[model samples]
Target chain A: MQWSHNMRFFQSYAMKKQLWIIVVIIIAAILPTIIGAFWINVAVEILIMGLFAVSFNMIFGYMGQLSFGHAAFYGVGAYTVGLLMAKLSIPFSLSLIAAMLSAGAFALIIGYFCIRLTGIYFAILTLSFGQLIYYIVFEWYSFTGGDNGLQGIAAPHLLSSVTAYYYFTLVIVIAALIVMWYISRSPFGYTMRAIRDNANRTRFLGINVKRYMLINFVIAGAFAGLAGGLWGPFNQSISPDLLNWTESGIPVFMTVIGGSASFLGPMVGSIIYTFLNAFVTGFTQYWPLIIGIVIMLIILFSPGGIQGLIDKWYKHSDSSDENIEL
Target chain B: METGGRNSGSKSEREEITGESMDFSLIFSQFLSGLSRGAMLFLIASGLSLIFGVMNILNFAHAALWLVGAYLAYTFWNLLQPYGFSLWVSIPLAAVALSAIGWAIERVLIRRIYNRTLSEQLVFTFAMILVIDNLIKIIWGVQDKAIVRPSIVASPVFIFGAPLDSYFIFVIFTGAVVAIGLWWFLSKTKYGHIIKAAVFSREMVSALGIPVPKIYTWVFVLGIFLAGLAGGVQAPIGSITLGMDNAVIIQAFIVVVIGGFGSLLGTLVGSIIVGEIYAFSILFWPDGAMILIFVVAAIMLIIRPWGLFGTPMRT
Candidate 1:
């Protein structure tokens, strides 16, 4: 009887989750109609950055490692698409694939060196390697256009309209998120959680901890690159700054703000962060100061972030009337 | 010592281009420049090492604080410009000011997050950087501030026929004095011993009635004080500009990593190696200099994650 009661509770929970997802998607579909062109652009950014932050959470949330150089992969992805589209006149779809492949390749190399250590050492190594890539891109004037950055990256005619681009990004991001969601639910995902919770114990259980970490790292990099690839045609330009340490901090901020424990936390964080960025910059130039204070508050008072807050309230409401006696 | 190497500037340039027939004096000058660079790094990184070593809190705001120090030094120097020893007075004053700020930060913010996760601690400090940097913008504006050197060290000094920047001598002297001073304090003082014990086990030290939080506050202040001093010393070397801390902070992190965390001798050696590497690489491969330093640091991290002088027990 108790088991059945628990099963009913979980079933309702899952149904509610699916219902919420559908509602969000429907809202997203009609968003361009309701909002202005300016907001449409911001929505596009929210999707792209949301995808980036989620991928970063693959390391931070699931794998339990902090990668300060995640932007390197993002930057590489952007540069790949920017160069391919602008220089070779490659189709946008092909360019994005190339971006993912190239970013994955770089991650494979950088991650091989990075996965050897954990904790602060991991963060520092990734940062150094990221800077190495940044310097190369910054200095290689002939190929990368140096500090001038690559300009004139126009989207294809089909995506030329802001609304069309928004829809396109929506489709791609939703597909990516679904794939990541499945991965997070799979046995492989459970293994990652095990490794995160206890690496030594997981090793004793015959799981290859390092190999799993490296694979997760590469997957995260590829998705971040995909997000980066989308950015070039949308923004119409790409700079070395995209791959910088500061840029890497963006996804981290989003992940923290949204709540790392929940899968969709980063997306929610992206909504709040990107919207606030668009709104705040309109009036004041002290956006950094504002964001800094917000992050500090989140860390100090609500370390679990907005999602954590919601989860707490949710459990509170559920347990009040439906307390099960075990 | 051949006078020919000194006279023929074009010849040396040609030699540099061709990568052949390098003069001894040119190498000596590079070495001296490297030494000065190392000294500057030491001034910034030693404090970082100390804070991380004792508190286990990697202060991402260390560089930002250093930048603040530079701006403070400029402000003090500007106010005391009529005085002959204005630069000297301003440097220490800047350091003292930074110490006060550090104390406030420790009491209000850092003290709250002593038990938070590593990522939380990192995020907190990182946020501090953003707050501090923007505050600086609001206060100092965007314009670059340059300090004029006093007549005492205004001109280049001949060091073994190399025209070394005279102010660099002062920088090197200050670095050595601080390093020796830090070494002595850590080894010789009662508070220093308590701080070391806290690093090993904060609970044990607290159990012994040492007030570990007080030590943490002072250590943080001490770290920021060094950063401020480094900034003041750096003021006369070039224009104090916004975002200078961005580059220095990364390099300082590299120095701390290369030097074992918590080891004074290690930080010294690491700073010199980095300083020299940067100096020589700029001579041969200007574009690759920063890249090479990063490569070395990555290699060190891979092989010795704790660093050369750091114990594996910390890891």
Candidate 2:
């Protein structure tokens, strides 16, 4: 009788949580309509970067590896889309697929070399690979338009309108997030976590750690490419600078600042960083300095990030029920 | 085997060009340029290797310090020019300024993060790069600055029948002097042994009444000083631009990685190898010169991930 009561209580709590999620989703759906044009555009950027960060988190947070060159995949995706649309006049859907495939290929090649090394060495190799991609893209002047980049990327008629494009991006991001969430909860994710926690022990258990990491890397790259594909049409241009190591640092910053411990941490980081970028750049060209100082403070003072602070506050306020999961 | 073939190929090419029984003169010119390039790399990579050796921290901001060194040299040159000062005076002055800045960074920021994770250390130093890059813009403006060579060393000298720039010779000489000085300090001096011992076991050194933190601060300062000195010297050869820091830093990183981080002799050999490769590759494969560095480093990792001289970590 006690077990039945406990199950009923949990069901009710789960239903309530689902309801809350539905409400948040509805709010997000209608947000662009209520916001100004400028804010809506910013929202588009936030959504794209948020997706990128979430994908990045799969490796950094879930897999316990930091890839310092994630932007290379993102740039590859953008360039693939831009080139396909500008040169071959491929349809939007096909171009998007191509972008993901290309980025996935890139991740596979880079990760083959990278996954063998751990910690700082992995970070450096990824960084070097990222720079290599940037240099190639920068130097291939005829095809990539050199440093000028590709412009006038064509979008499908349905996505021609800014509002329509925004909604399209919103739907794609939400679907991607759902798929990502499912994957995280799957057996593969558990193995990933196992490897991350103790790779040697995981290896002793007869699991091929490197292969799993490579697959995760490919998945992460594909998602980043998807975001980059969206970005090319949104901006109507793409540059080699997109692949710069400094740009790679953005996802890292977002993951760390948003809290790398939780599922939603990188998304939160993306949102905060997007807003911070939009807000700070409006006032000063010294944005790098401000962003640098803010990140430093976050590292020094709030190592666990915003989510961590919230968890602490929740624990303090609700001592009777301290087992809340976020 | 392939490298051997490439070397002989280049030598034959040199022989054909010079049209001589002995192409020693032609080879000598290549050697001279390689030495100069390697020396500059050494100045930067040694510092990077030393810091990693001691603290296990890959200081990204070291590159920014190089930029600071260049800009400071520019500023000091302009100021001292009115008072009849030379490039020599300005270069050393810039080095001192950088040392101060490096010391401040260690004491105020890096000193607190000795026990933090590697990711945190990288990001924190990366943040410093952003701050310093922007600060350079705010202080020095966005324009590239050029420094004229000192009048005393403005002309080329005929060495081994090659007209090498006097400034290049000076740079080579400075690098050699520093290399010898560092060698003496590390291998022959008591302080050098202390630093090495500290790198091997920090706790044991501390337990033996050594102020490990103080030693670390000084070592970091020394690293900074080298970076600054490199920038000051390089400023005359190339214009100081916004992106120069990243350009040099990446190359220096490749040098350190190839040489094996935390090993002085490794750094020396790595720099020379890289420098020679860079010098010759420009002649044979101009378009892919930069890519060659990455390729070599990749091969090195494949063959020996711990680097040529670096000790592998115990997992």
Candidate 3:
């Protein structure tokens, strides 16, 4: 009887979450129509970057390992698509798949070694590996275009317009988010949380800790690649900068800004970050300084980020309601 | 004559790939170049290692600060350009100025994050890099700044048929003095022992009534001072420009990792290894130098995460 009651409670909570998402989707679908072309471009960027940040949070928030080189996978994904379409004349859809696959493959190799150590060592190893890839891409002028970057990557006729690209990104991003949401709610996700909370105990329970972490890392990398795949055609080009360490910091900034504890925190972070980037750069070139000051304030005053702040407010209101009822 | 003949015989084999004859003079020159390169790296990495070793904060903004030091040195030298001793005077002055700035940063920003999660600390410092870099651009403008070297160290010096820039000798000399000075401070001085103790267990040091926060501030200041000195030393070697810190910070990180975090001797040794690898690799594989360094760093990280001289502490 108690189990049944708990199940009902969970079901209603899930229903509320689903309803909220539906409302959000409706708003997103209408956003391009209401906003100007410039804002529409910004929205597309927000969606792609949001997806990237969400993928990053899989390893960061769930698995509790900071992969500083995550941008390597993203870069690989972009390069895969860029090369496929530009060189082999592959279809956009097929190139994206290739991007995901290539990014995952790279992740498997890199993550295999990275999962051996935890904390700062993991971060450094990932960074070194990322730099390794960056140099390869940077120096291979004949193949990867070196510092010149790959140009003339046009999207399909259907997604050539900014509005069309925004819709396409919205659909793909929604699907990716749904898939990730299910993964986060699955038993595998719980197992990751267990490992994060207490790796020793998780091992004692006869789980393969390293294997699970590696799998998580690969999944995150693949998703980041998916986001990267979207980037090349959207921007009409790709560069070696996509895989640079500075690019890796983008998702990190988003995750920290949004709140790493919540599943959708990074997405929220991407929205605020990308939107502000678009808005701020319109006026001044000191975007980095401004963002730096904002991040500093956020870290100093509210380490939990925007989601954490909202959750606190919600809980505070809930307590007041209980007080009134009593 | 026999050695020369043997070298000539092998030169044809090497020349096909490298396009340069492998001779005693070439090898000796490369070795000296590597030594000077290693010394510069040592100057930068030692402070970075010390800060991370004691404070448990891996500062991402370190190279940016180092860049700031270089810019400050330029400004100082520019002011004193009329004097012959300008370059010599500016280097120490820049380091002292940087120490003051370091102390302010520690008290204001770093002190708050002492107990935060590792990611938070890393992100904070990363953000600092962005802010600091931009500030550098605003203050110094986007143009590259070059310092003219004094006559004393203006020309190339020949050692055993190898020509080296005279300023590099000064850089090497400064590196050695700083390395020795740091070793003495860490090993022989009372505060150095306190710092060593703090690295092992901060709580215990604090429990013993030693001001851990004060130690942290001073250590940070000292580290920044070294960075400043390095920057001042580096300014004349090449033109100081925007985005120079980006490449250097990563290289320094590699140096610290290869040496083992918090190990002074390891940093020195690792710097030399990297320096030699970088200098020599340019001969055989010019394009692959950076790639080779990264590969070596990755291998070191995989095989011995604790590094050569560092003992494994917390996971």
Candidate 4:
């Protein structure tokens, strides 16, 4: 009787959580109708960049490796769609898959070299690879449009409206986020955290650390590419600047600001950063300076970020209550 | 970025004018150019190598200091334009200013995060880049600036039957002098030995009553000084633009990686290798030269994971 009661309570709790998630999704779906075009566009950007940040956190937060070349995969995904739609006149849905594939393939190659080292060396190598991609995109004028960038990219007529595109982006981004959430809870995620904590001990256990990391790298790239695929159509263009290390730095900054300790930390960070960027850039051109100061403060004062602060408060309250009870 | 094209265009035009005799001169001149390029890289990477050896932190914004130096040099040069020794007077001034800035950054920002993770250090410096870059833009505006080479070094001089720019030769000389001076300082001076000792075992050095943090500040300042010197010198040879921070820093990283992060001697050799590769690539494959650096670095990394001159790290 006691076991059955506990099971009923757990089932109800799970249902409530699912219901909340559904309600959130419904709100997100209707957001375009409620908001203006500018805000809806901002919303689309937030979702895409949010996915990018989450994918980046997989390597940084979960795998304990900060891969700085993330934007390279993101750019590759964007360019794949941009090129396919603009040059080959392919369907938008097919272009998205191709974007994921191309980005994943690129990640596999770069990750092979990058995974050989750890810590700062890995960061440098990934950054170098990213810059190489940017250089290619900038110099290869015939294919990439060089400095001018590729433009006029869009989805099919049915999804041509801004409202329709927002919904499309929302659905794809949510699906990707769900898959990422699943991966984080899976045994592979446990092994990742183990490797992060102690690679040698994990190696002693007969796990191929590098191979697992490479797999993680490839999956992260595929998801970043998905974000990029959405980005190309939404922005209606793609540029070499998308592959620049500055762009790569965005995810890093977001992850740190959002708190890398929790699974949803990067997603929360993405929302904050996107909104901050949208709002801040309107006030001053020295946004980078402001951003730098913000990041430095976060690193110094709240290394785990806003989510970390909340957790600390919750824990402190919980412990204090127990002490009072005692 | 147009710096690449302008430099290449002038080289090709000079080749067209020289015509048949261009081959021998081209090889010799390219070699000279390569050496000068390597020397500049050495100037930048030597400081980076020192900081990494002693602090074990790679300051990604080290390149931003170089940009700052270039801009300061531009300012000083313009202010002292009436003076006959404008370039001579301005370069050292820029280097000094940069050292002060570096000192503050090390004390105020870097000191706060000494106990944090490597990723935090990287993010800190990366943020520093954004801050510095914007500060530069705010002060200097978005336009690219260039200094006129001092009249003494502006003209080309005939050396080995090839006309080489005096400024280029001077850069090579400056690089060699700095390298030798650094070696002497490390090997001969008491403080230099302390710095080296600090790199080996900071806790032990600190336990022995040496102020380790002070040494770190001095080492960081010296690194920034070298970066400033490289930038000030290059201001005349190349355009000092808003994005030069990003452009040169990656090359500096390639130099450090090839030289082994903490090894000065390795930095010198790596700089030469990269410089020569860049020079030859300009002659043969201009469009792909930048990509080639990453490719070579990747290959070197895979073959010798610690780098050519780097010792294996335990982590």
Top DockQ hit: 3
Better of 2 and 3 by TM-score: 3
User: Candidate 3 — which residues are off by over 4 angstroms?
Assistant: A1-19, A317-326, B1-22
Error of 2 at B172 (Å): 1.6
Candidate 3 residue lDDT tens string, B1-315? 333233344444434423344366578778878888999889889889999999999999999999999999999999999999999999999999999999999999999999999999999999999999999999999999999998878877554444568788798899899999999999999999999998889999999999888999999999999999999899999999999999899999999999999999999999999999999998999889899999999999999999988888865
lDDT tens digits, residue span B245-287, model 2 = 8777877888887888788988999999888887777777775
Residues A56-118, model 2: lDDT tens digits? 988887788888889999999999999999999999889999999999999999888888988
User: For candidate 4, what's the TM-score of chain A, rounded to 2 decimals?
Assistant: 0.90
Q: Candidate 4 on B154-257: residue-level lDDT in tens?
A: 77764433577879988999899999999999989999999888877788999999988889899999999998898788788878889787877888888888
Q: Write the per-residue lDDT of candidate 3 for residues A183-263, one digit (tens) a residue.
A: 887888888988888899999999999999999999999999999999999999999999999999999999999988888
* Candidate 1 residue-wise lDDT, A1-326, digit = tens: 97787677666765776788899999999999999999999999999999999999999998889999999999999999999999999999999999999999999999998988888999999999999999899989999998899999999999999999999999999999989988888888879988888899999999889999999999999999999999999999999999889999999999899989888989999999999999999999999999999999999998878877876654443332111110
Model number with the top TM-score: 1
Which ten residues in a row are the worst by lDDT in model 1 chain A?
A317-326
Q: Name every residue pair that clashes in candidate 4.
A: none
Q: Give the DockQ (2 decimals) of all models.
A: 0.75, 0.46, 0.76, 0.62
Off by over 4 Å in 2: A1-24, A317-326, B1-30, B158-163
What 10-residue stretch in candidate 1 chain B is worst by lDDT?
Answer: B13-22
